[model samples]
Target: MPEPDEICGVNIAFAVVGSKWKPTILWVLAGRPHRFAELRRAVGGISEKVLAAQLRELERDGVVCREAGAGFPLNVRYSLTPAGVTLDRLLEPLAEWGHQLQRGR
Candidate 1:
């Protein structure tokens, strides 16, 4: 697989978080670890299949971590990894910029 660092930082960042639902996913998870259903609710319009696919992609990119518990009824939770935390920090300024742009518009 091609490594993200091999490319420009902006390209890699976009590759990881540029999808319609991904930045929202990262924003939600930045607050705290959440269960799948909770994330579904928090993210608003994303379907189960799409959410799962996005989460899988994020996990593959090492930006998100999934924890599974063993039992008759399994419990799973997702949280941001260190890299994800760094991305979240970066997103803060971008989000502010969006807000300022909207105000200007």
Candidate 2:
């Protein structure tokens, strides 16, 4: 069931992961958990401010999880939530499609 404002499942999904960096972020996180710095490096070309903002958004949407280790340095790690893992799996076809498109061009 969907609300009137939602329109459809596609729109709902896009609303959650439609940003330029969101898919790439999810793709990187799919490999394994990463610290903030590691994620920033893995998802290159994105500014710190943008990465932070996108991560926060993903976390808020329940697609990502942030865990803080108990230590003086306060290590923080980011990983895909169950929902995010499912989303990442769903994106595989899209990724393959993109590769095909790139090869065609």
Candidate 3:
């Protein structure tokens, strides 16, 4: 097992993804890159402003990429970066763990 640099990793993990809607955002975007509106739609219940801020934070943390898209509206899409890709891979099992805990309850 790898020893964590921080004594409390749960705190750190929460710091990264602890936002009300970030985990869902990451999960939805895991399938493919999404436009700003698309992410809001998929995430459900997040306000436009909050989603935009979270996306910016994700981009800053190297978790998401902001890219310009094609067409008339001049779309902007967000994709998981290499770091986010690795994080998504890690999150899958963590998701299962949460499900298992739900089952046990």
- Scanning candidate 2 in windows of ten residues, the lowest lDDT window is 1-10
User: Which regions of candidate 2 are displaced past 4 Å?
Assistant: 1-7
lDDT per residue, candidate 2, 1-105, as tens digits?
767775777787898999899999999999999999989999999999999999999999999999999997999999999999999999999889989999999
Model 3, residue pairs in steric clash: none
Q: Candidate 2, after superposition: displacement of residue 56 in Å?
A: 0.5
Best by TM-score, which number?
1
For candidate 3, lDDT tens digit of each residue in 18-47? Answer: 787888888888999998887889999999
- The lDDT of each candidate is 0.95, 0.95, 0.85
Tell me which of candidates 1 and 2 scores higher on TM-score: 1
RMSD of 2: 2.9
Residue clash pairs of candidate 2? none
Candidate 1 C-alpha error for residue 50, in Å: 0.4
What is the per-residue lDDT of model 1 for residues 1-105, given as tens digits with 9 covering 90 to 100?
A: 556665687887999999899999999999999999999999999999999999999999999999997875889999999999999899899989999999999
> What value of lDDT does candidate 1 attain over all alpha carbons?
0.95
On lDDT, who's better, 2 or 3?
2
